[model samples]
Target chain A: MSKPLILVTNDDGITAPGIRKLISIVNEIGDVIVVAPNSPQSGKGHAITINSTLSFEELNLDGPQRDFSCSGTPVDCVKMALDKILPRKPDLVVSGINHGANSSINVIYSGTMSAAVEAGVEGLQAIGFSLSDLKWDADFDQAEEFIKEIILKTLENPMPKGIVLNVNIPKLPKEDIKGIKVCKQANAKWEESFDERTNPHGTKYYWLTGYFNNMDESEDADETALANGYISIVPVKFDLTAYEYMNELNSVYQ
Target chain B: MSKPLILVTNDDGITAPGIRKLISIVNEIGDVIVVAPNSPQSGKGHAITINSTLSFEELNLDGPQRDFSCSGTPVDCVKMALDKILPRKPDLVVSGINHGANSSINVIYSGTMSAAVEAGVEGLQAIGFSLSDLKWDADFDQAEEFIKEIILKTLENPMPKGIVLNVNIPKLPKEDIKGIKVCKQANAKWEESFDERTNPHGTKYYWLTGYFNNMDESEDADETALANGYISIVPVKFDLTAYEYMNELNSVYQ
Candidate 1:
């Protein structure tokens, strides 16, 4: 029997340890195809390269899966894969196992989740996985069992239209880690600060910096669940319409 | 009496006529401050510049408002403006008088709308206005009155938190226009295609192109309203969590 076709990609460049671990894990369950950015695209959001031309090259990444690294954003990789590279429509599209977190409000600025959401927009069942750690050599070995379970369950039960799961793993050791929890997005924000610097040519420039502030403490929020030592799965959707305010907004036009 | 602080921005660069008109329109009602990209940033989506240094220069645009041109994406401009440029938290953030359509699924790839969404994330009232015409010389005269009305109404009646308006004006003569309609985002998508080309060096490159495919013909859809010659206003939100599917998804983990 043919295996389920899985498309694996990440926001961390193609050679990142995170995607390497993800590819190996998924290879055990499906026929994997790897199409990811050639360079890091950390906070690209749902960006697509419209003005520039794109080029890609084949890679020999010690895997059975056909791999190609493309010069584009994470969302662009998804589009290119669907249109040019994939053998057919993938059964599941999984992104990330990112080097950093993509939970709470971070999802809006996340290239990993944006790739997953782009797949959702194309009517594909997708998931984005991330760890709380920012290290390139972070411990992904601990997430093997739970990640496999979630992927298997998702394959068995397709995600509903317009929805995808954003799964974030706590940075705990294997045995000490608790279970998984389905939760809502936490109300968190980045308290941004700019580090000002002066160039040798007498010009001032700034580097963006910020710290994540998780404001929600509700038991069902992703932040709370992760704080309690469980992996948090938040169902994310692409429809940005605020349906509740539609009626009131209409009244304004009246 | 102090004027309301109105922050103006666009994805089409600070010199685009669309935003110049927007600046003029808002100047009548508020003290305007324009902080936009130094070059055209069309289709940049919600991207932010993380790995690069950002630079901005005060501009001498012919208006009562202060102007600054920044070397960043639309979302970056918003962040930079709020963090360093603006005198205070703007009473309202107005993005675009975008020179093309940002209706239906186009909203996802829109830098113009992303600026407003970023403002919404920062807990500010924001609106993104776009015209269906893509011409640099498109007529903005007809939109003057209606745009002012919407802005004034929005200022008088503050929008709820996390919500921003995406207003798309049809490219019709003002006389033939049928006012405005508050509508939901149409269930539409892009039928993406990549045009392949090979350089003399024999390496293949792809240029992204696509056409909008609107599958929803429902009465209250933004696409439907635009087709009927009416200005379409969709109240968009940044929170991506799908609430209804959370229960069923939780059952899977159980």
Candidate 2:
């Protein structure tokens, strides 16, 4: 049988240590190709380049996988990768091994998960991985085995249509890990906090800063799972429709 | 009591005619404040600026409302407005009078809807308004009464928490329009089409272009309502969790 084809990407730019680890892991499983943003696009959720043109250059990176960096958002990289670079439709699209957490409400602000969601939007199977640690030299070694296991399992048993997996590893060693937990997105958000500062030019500028507020600590919540030292996997979807509220909304308009 | 504080914003920049019309319509209804992007930020779905600084300048626009043009994405405008400009947490947040349609699947890629969704995330009553016509001089006069009715109704009869309204008007005259229909988002997507070209330096550059493909023609869908000459309203939620597939996904992981 032919090997599975995997496309790897990240929001931390092409040369980040995180993507390099992701490439190494997926290389053993499939014919891997890396198409990612040329710069860090951490909070660029589902953004695409509409008013601008896009360009990309091939790279001679150290890996069996082919890598190219595109001058656009993470979603744009996925769009451009599918249109220009790939020889055929990839069997699976995997993103990240990201440097920080995308466990709950962070998914909306995360470029890593947005790339995965964009792939899901295209009707392809995709997954996004993130570690709870933000340090560049953060230990990715612990996530290796479980990452391989999850990829192999996904390849073996495909998910339903319009669903992708968001996997966030706890910031603990492999031995300290309490195994994987499939959970729901926790009700969480960043409290809107902007740090106001003044520049030397006499004009005032502000920096967007926020404190992470985990509003749900329920057993099934991804935040709870992560806090309990388990890798949390939440089945993610791109459809933003609130199905439960439709009938009531219909009545209101009627 | 002071009138309802209605915050108005858009992805088409603060100076666009659509917003000017929106500001005029809402001026009679409430004490309004406008905080929108300095430039057009269409298709900037839910993006925020974490790695940079932001600046805004207040302007004395024609209405009772104060207007500020901020150097950030649509989502950024909402955050900044809440954190700095507004006198208090707003009574309502209204986005757009967008120059194009945001019915059905278009909501995922829309900065107009993103701004509304951002407001919804902050637990505010929010609504996004869009018109089917993309013309600079498209007629918005037809939507005045209904927009007021919806806003007034929304204030009097609050929608359930965490749900925002996505209202799209068809390109029809006031009389010919078939009033309003509350509906669900149609399953639709942009058929991936990239226009590849070479720059003067012989380097390849691409334009992100596509045809809108309406996959679902269900009578209750937003697209269907719009196509049949009625304004469509779909309740949008920011939570992208696939709740229906959770149990099955858990079993697969187990």
Most lDDT-accurate candidate = 1
lDDT of each: 0.93, 0.91
Q: Which 10-residue window of candidate 2 chain A scores lowest in summed lDDT?
A: A245-254
In candidate 1, list every pair of residues with a backbone clash: none
In model 1, where do residues sit more than 4 Å from their true spots?
none
lDDT (10s digit) by residue, model 1, range A28-81 = 999999999999999998899988999888899797888999999999999999
Compared with the real two-chain complex, what DockQ does model 1 have? 0.87
What DockQ score does model 2 reach against the true complex? 0.82
lDDT by residue for model 2 over B55-122, one digit each (tens)?
A: 99998777688999999999999999999999899999999999999997789789999999999988
lDDT of 2 by residue, A62-171 (tens): 87899999999999999999989999999999999899999888898889999999888888999999999999999999999999999999999888778999999999
Cα distance off (Å), candidate 2, residue B109: 1.2
